[model samples]
Target: MAEKKANPALMKPLTPSPELAAVVGSDPLPRPEVVSKVWDYIKKHDLQNPQNKREIIADEKLQPVFGKDRVTMFEMNKHLSRHLHS
Candidate 1:
Protein backbone atom coordinates (compact mmCIF):
# COMPACT_ATOMS: atom_id res chain seq x y z
CA MET A 1 0.00 0.00 0.00
CA ALA A 2 1.18 3.49 -0.82
CA GLU A 3 0.94 6.34 1.64
CA LYS A 4 -1.26 9.23 0.59
CA LYS A 5 0.51 12.49 -0.13
CA ALA A 6 -0.86 15.95 0.36
CA ASN A 7 -1.94 17.82 -2.74
CA PRO A 8 0.75 20.22 -3.84
CA ALA A 9 -1.77 22.60 -5.33
CA LEU A 10 -3.53 22.85 -2.02
CA MET A 11 -0.25 23.64 -0.25
CA LYS A 12 1.04 26.12 -2.80
CA PRO A 13 1.06 29.63 -1.48
CA LEU A 14 -1.40 32.03 -3.08
CA THR A 15 -1.33 35.80 -3.04
CA PRO A 16 -4.27 37.56 -1.47
CA SER A 17 -5.87 40.67 -2.95
CA PRO A 18 -5.48 43.97 -1.14
CA GLU A 19 -8.99 43.75 0.26
CA LEU A 20 -8.33 40.27 1.58
CA ALA A 21 -4.95 41.40 2.87
CA ALA A 22 -6.75 43.75 5.19
CA VAL A 23 -8.04 40.73 7.10
CA VAL A 24 -5.51 37.97 6.32
CA GLY A 25 -2.35 40.00 5.83
CA SER A 26 -0.27 40.46 2.64
CA ASP A 27 1.95 37.44 2.98
CA PRO A 28 1.34 34.58 0.57
CA LEU A 29 -0.49 31.68 2.21
CA PRO A 30 -2.05 28.37 1.29
CA ARG A 31 -5.80 28.19 0.69
CA PRO A 32 -6.50 26.38 3.94
CA GLU A 33 -4.43 28.88 5.92
CA VAL A 34 -6.19 31.77 4.19
CA VAL A 35 -9.56 30.31 5.12
CA SER A 36 -8.34 29.67 8.66
CA LYS A 37 -7.10 33.23 9.01
CA VAL A 38 -10.35 34.60 7.62
CA TRP A 39 -12.23 32.53 10.19
CA ASP A 40 -9.92 33.82 12.89
CA TYR A 41 -10.60 37.38 11.79
CA ILE A 42 -14.34 36.73 11.74
CA LYS A 43 -14.17 35.21 15.19
CA LYS A 44 -11.98 37.99 16.52
CA HIS A 45 -14.44 40.58 15.31
CA ASP A 46 -17.58 38.53 16.05
CA LEU A 47 -18.74 38.91 12.45
CA GLN A 48 -20.90 35.83 12.31
CA ASN A 49 -24.61 36.56 12.47
CA PRO A 50 -26.12 35.45 15.78
CA GLN A 51 -29.55 35.01 14.20
CA ASN A 52 -28.18 32.66 11.60
CA LYS A 53 -24.88 30.93 12.18
CA ARG A 54 -24.68 30.19 8.47
CA GLU A 55 -24.57 33.88 7.64
CA ILE A 56 -21.51 36.12 8.07
CA ILE A 57 -21.94 39.78 8.72
CA ALA A 58 -19.27 41.72 6.90
CA ASP A 59 -17.38 44.51 8.56
CA GLU A 60 -15.58 47.46 7.00
CA LYS A 61 -12.42 45.47 6.41
CA LEU A 62 -14.41 42.64 4.88
CA GLN A 63 -16.79 44.69 2.80
CA PRO A 64 -14.59 44.74 -0.29
CA VAL A 65 -13.59 41.15 0.11
CA PHE A 66 -17.15 39.98 0.55
CA GLY A 67 -18.67 42.60 -1.81
CA LYS A 68 -21.93 42.79 0.17
CA ASP A 69 -22.78 43.36 3.81
CA ARG A 70 -23.69 39.73 4.43
CA VAL A 71 -22.89 36.35 2.92
CA THR A 72 -23.69 32.73 3.61
CA MET A 73 -20.90 30.40 4.75
CA PHE A 74 -21.21 28.60 1.42
CA GLU A 75 -20.87 31.85 -0.54
CA MET A 76 -17.80 32.94 1.39
CA ASN A 77 -15.60 30.53 -0.55
CA LYS A 78 -16.83 31.95 -3.83
CA HIS A 79 -16.02 35.46 -2.71
CA LEU A 80 -12.65 34.42 -1.34
CA SER A 81 -11.77 32.72 -4.57
CA ARG A 82 -12.17 35.99 -6.42
CA HIS A 83 -9.66 37.59 -4.08
CA LEU A 84 -7.07 34.82 -4.28
CA HIS A 85 -4.59 34.02 -7.02
CA SER A 86 -1.67 31.70 -7.47
Candidate 2:
Protein backbone atom coordinates (compact mmCIF):
# COMPACT_ATOMS: atom_id res chain seq x y z
CA MET A 1 0.00 0.00 0.00
CA ALA A 2 1.07 3.54 -0.69
CA GLU A 3 0.34 6.71 1.22
CA LYS A 4 -2.14 9.03 -0.46
CA LYS A 5 -1.60 12.77 -0.58
CA ALA A 6 -3.97 15.66 -1.08
CA ASN A 7 -4.00 17.19 -4.53
CA PRO A 8 -1.91 20.34 -4.73
CA ALA A 9 -4.40 21.94 -7.09
CA LEU A 10 -7.15 21.47 -4.53
CA MET A 11 -5.00 23.19 -1.93
CA LYS A 12 -4.13 26.15 -4.15
CA PRO A 13 -5.43 29.49 -2.91
CA LEU A 14 -7.67 31.54 -5.17
CA THR A 15 -8.83 35.14 -5.12
CA PRO A 16 -12.54 35.88 -5.25
CA SER A 17 -14.24 38.58 -7.31
CA PRO A 18 -15.96 41.44 -5.55
CA GLU A 19 -19.37 39.87 -5.90
CA LEU A 20 -18.23 36.59 -4.39
CA ALA A 21 -16.39 38.50 -1.71
CA ALA A 22 -19.72 39.83 -0.51
CA VAL A 23 -20.73 36.33 0.59
CA VAL A 24 -17.42 34.51 1.09
CA GLY A 25 -15.29 37.43 2.23
CA SER A 26 -12.36 39.22 0.58
CA ASP A 27 -9.64 36.68 1.10
CA PRO A 28 -7.65 34.16 -0.90
CA LEU A 29 -9.05 30.67 -0.13
CA PRO A 30 -8.86 27.13 -1.37
CA ARG A 31 -11.75 26.01 -3.56
CA PRO A 32 -13.14 23.76 -0.82
CA GLU A 33 -13.02 26.57 1.73
CA VAL A 34 -14.74 28.91 -0.68
CA VAL A 35 -17.52 26.40 -1.24
CA SER A 36 -17.81 25.83 2.50
CA LYS A 37 -18.12 29.55 3.11
CA VAL A 38 -20.72 29.89 0.40
CA TRP A 39 -22.70 27.06 1.95
CA ASP A 40 -22.42 28.73 5.31
CA TYR A 41 -23.80 31.91 3.83
CA ILE A 42 -26.61 30.03 2.16
CA LYS A 43 -27.55 28.30 5.41
CA LYS A 44 -27.24 31.47 7.45
CA HIS A 45 -29.47 33.34 5.02
CA ASP A 46 -31.89 30.45 4.35
CA LEU A 47 -31.45 30.80 0.62
CA GLN A 48 -32.46 27.26 -0.31
CA ASN A 49 -35.82 26.96 -2.02
CA PRO A 50 -38.41 25.45 0.30
CA GLN A 51 -40.13 23.38 -2.38
CA ASN A 52 -36.92 22.22 -3.96
CA LYS A 53 -33.90 22.07 -1.74
CA ARG A 54 -31.79 21.58 -4.83
CA GLU A 55 -32.52 25.11 -5.91
CA ILE A 56 -31.06 28.24 -4.39
CA ILE A 57 -32.71 31.63 -4.46
CA ALA A 58 -30.34 34.49 -4.81
CA ASP A 59 -30.48 37.28 -2.28
CA GLU A 60 -29.12 40.78 -2.84
CA LYS A 61 -25.63 39.78 -1.80
CA LEU A 62 -25.65 36.78 -4.15
CA GLN A 63 -27.39 38.36 -7.15
CA PRO A 64 -24.24 39.69 -8.77
CA VAL A 65 -22.39 36.46 -8.25
CA PHE A 66 -25.16 34.30 -9.68
CA GLY A 67 -26.40 36.80 -12.23
CA LYS A 68 -29.89 35.36 -11.86
CA ASP A 69 -32.64 35.05 -9.28
CA ARG A 70 -32.39 31.28 -8.95
CA VAL A 71 -30.00 28.44 -9.68
CA THR A 72 -29.85 24.69 -9.18
CA MET A 73 -27.29 23.49 -6.67
CA PHE A 74 -25.39 21.83 -9.50
CA GLU A 75 -25.22 25.16 -11.32
CA MET A 76 -23.84 26.93 -8.28
CA ASN A 77 -20.32 25.61 -8.87
CA LYS A 78 -20.31 27.05 -12.39
CA HIS A 79 -21.30 30.47 -11.10
CA LEU A 80 -18.75 30.29 -8.33
CA SER A 81 -16.05 29.33 -10.84
CA ARG A 82 -16.60 32.56 -12.74
CA HIS A 83 -15.98 34.49 -9.54
CA LEU A 84 -12.68 32.86 -8.58
CA HIS A 85 -9.17 33.22 -9.95
CA SER A 86 -5.91 31.50 -9.14
Candidate 3:
Protein backbone atom coordinates (compact mmCIF):
# COMPACT_ATOMS: atom_id res chain seq x y z
CA MET A 1 0.00 0.00 0.00
CA ALA A 2 1.12 3.53 -0.71
CA GLU A 3 0.84 6.51 1.62
CA LYS A 4 -1.47 9.26 0.48
CA LYS A 5 -0.68 12.94 0.78
CA ALA A 6 -3.17 15.64 1.57
CA ASN A 7 -4.20 17.89 -1.30
CA PRO A 8 -2.42 21.25 -1.25
CA ALA A 9 -5.50 23.01 -2.51
CA LEU A 10 -7.49 21.70 0.43
CA MET A 11 -4.76 22.75 2.81
CA LYS A 12 -4.43 26.27 1.41
CA PRO A 13 -5.89 29.03 3.52
CA LEU A 14 -8.93 30.87 2.20
CA THR A 15 -10.39 34.25 3.07
CA PRO A 16 -13.94 34.43 4.26
CA SER A 17 -16.55 36.90 3.08
CA PRO A 18 -17.85 39.52 5.51
CA GLU A 19 -20.99 37.53 6.08
CA LEU A 20 -19.03 34.43 6.97
CA ALA A 21 -16.56 36.34 9.10
CA ALA A 22 -19.32 37.21 11.50
CA VAL A 23 -19.49 33.58 12.52
CA VAL A 24 -15.94 32.32 11.85
CA GLY A 25 -13.80 35.43 12.45
CA SER A 26 -11.85 37.50 9.88
CA ASP A 27 -8.64 35.48 9.69
CA PRO A 28 -7.91 33.32 6.66
CA LEU A 29 -8.29 29.59 7.41
CA PRO A 30 -8.23 26.27 5.57
CA ARG A 31 -11.58 24.82 4.49
CA PRO A 32 -11.58 22.25 7.26
CA GLU A 33 -10.84 24.87 9.90
CA VAL A 34 -13.57 27.08 8.56
CA VAL A 35 -16.01 24.21 8.66
CA SER A 36 -14.92 23.39 12.18
CA LYS A 37 -15.40 26.93 13.33
CA VAL A 38 -18.81 27.12 11.73
CA TRP A 39 -19.80 23.92 13.44
CA ASP A 40 -18.54 25.28 16.72
CA TYR A 41 -20.59 28.41 16.25
CA ILE A 42 -23.62 26.32 15.38
CA LYS A 43 -23.20 24.17 18.44
CA LYS A 44 -22.49 27.15 20.68
CA HIS A 45 -25.61 28.89 19.48
CA ASP A 46 -27.80 25.80 19.56
CA LEU A 47 -28.69 26.25 15.93
CA GLN A 48 -29.26 22.62 15.12
CA ASN A 49 -32.87 21.60 15.29
CA PRO A 50 -33.66 19.26 18.18
CA GLN A 51 -36.30 17.35 16.31
CA ASN A 52 -34.19 17.00 13.18
CA LYS A 53 -30.48 16.89 13.90
CA ARG A 54 -29.71 17.13 10.19
CA GLU A 55 -31.30 20.54 9.88
CA ILE A 56 -29.69 23.82 10.94
CA ILE A 57 -31.79 26.74 12.05
CA ALA A 58 -29.92 29.88 11.12
CA ASP A 59 -29.49 32.75 13.50
CA GLU A 60 -29.24 36.39 12.45
CA LYS A 61 -25.46 36.25 11.98
CA LEU A 62 -25.72 33.12 9.85
CA GLN A 63 -28.62 34.23 7.68
CA PRO A 64 -26.51 35.95 5.03
CA VAL A 65 -24.27 32.94 4.50
CA PHE A 66 -27.04 30.36 4.72
CA GLY A 67 -29.45 32.49 2.63
CA LYS A 68 -32.48 31.14 4.46
CA ASP A 69 -33.89 30.35 7.88
CA ARG A 70 -32.86 26.72 7.68
CA VAL A 71 -30.55 24.35 5.82
CA THR A 72 -29.67 20.67 5.91
CA MET A 73 -26.29 19.57 7.20
CA PHE A 74 -25.39 18.19 3.75
CA GLU A 75 -26.17 21.54 2.14
CA MET A 76 -24.09 23.64 4.53
CA ASN A 77 -20.84 23.01 2.70
CA LYS A 78 -22.35 24.12 -0.58
CA HIS A 79 -23.50 27.37 1.03
CA LEU A 80 -20.12 27.90 2.70
CA SER A 81 -18.15 27.40 -0.53
CA ARG A 82 -19.70 30.58 -1.89
CA HIS A 83 -18.18 32.64 0.94
CA LEU A 84 -14.62 31.33 0.77
CA HIS A 85 -11.89 32.34 -1.68
CA SER A 86 -8.22 31.55 -2.03
Best by TM-score: 3
TM per candidate:
0.93, 0.94, 0.94
| lDDT per residue (tens digit) for residues 1-86 in model 3 | 99998899998999999999999999999999999999999999999999999999999999999999999999999999999988
Which predicted model would earn the best lDDT?
3
Tell me the lDDT of candidate 3. 0.97
Ranked by TM-score from best down, the candidates are 3, 2, 1
Task: Please give the distance, in angstroms, between residue 41's alpha carbon in candidate 1 and its true position after superposition.
Answer: 0.5
Report lDDT per candidate: 0.95, 0.95, 0.97
Q: Better model by TM-score, 1 or 3?
A: 3
Instruction: lDDT for model 2, please.
Output: 0.95
Candidate 1 has an lDDT of 0.95
Give lDDT tens digits, candidate 2, residues 1-86: 99998899988999999999999889999999999999999999999999999999999999999999999999999999999998
Per-residue lDDT for 1-86 in model 1, tens only? Answer: 99999899999999999999999999999999999999999999999999998999999999999999999999999999999998
Which pairs clash (backbone N, Cα, C closer than 3 Å) in model 3? none
What lDDT score is found at residue 12 in candidate 1?
A: 96
How far off is residue 65 in model 3, in Å? 0.4
**Between 2 and 3, whose lDDT is larger?**
3
List the lowest-lDDT window of 10 residues for candidate 2.
2-11
- Write out the backbone clash pairs for model 2: none
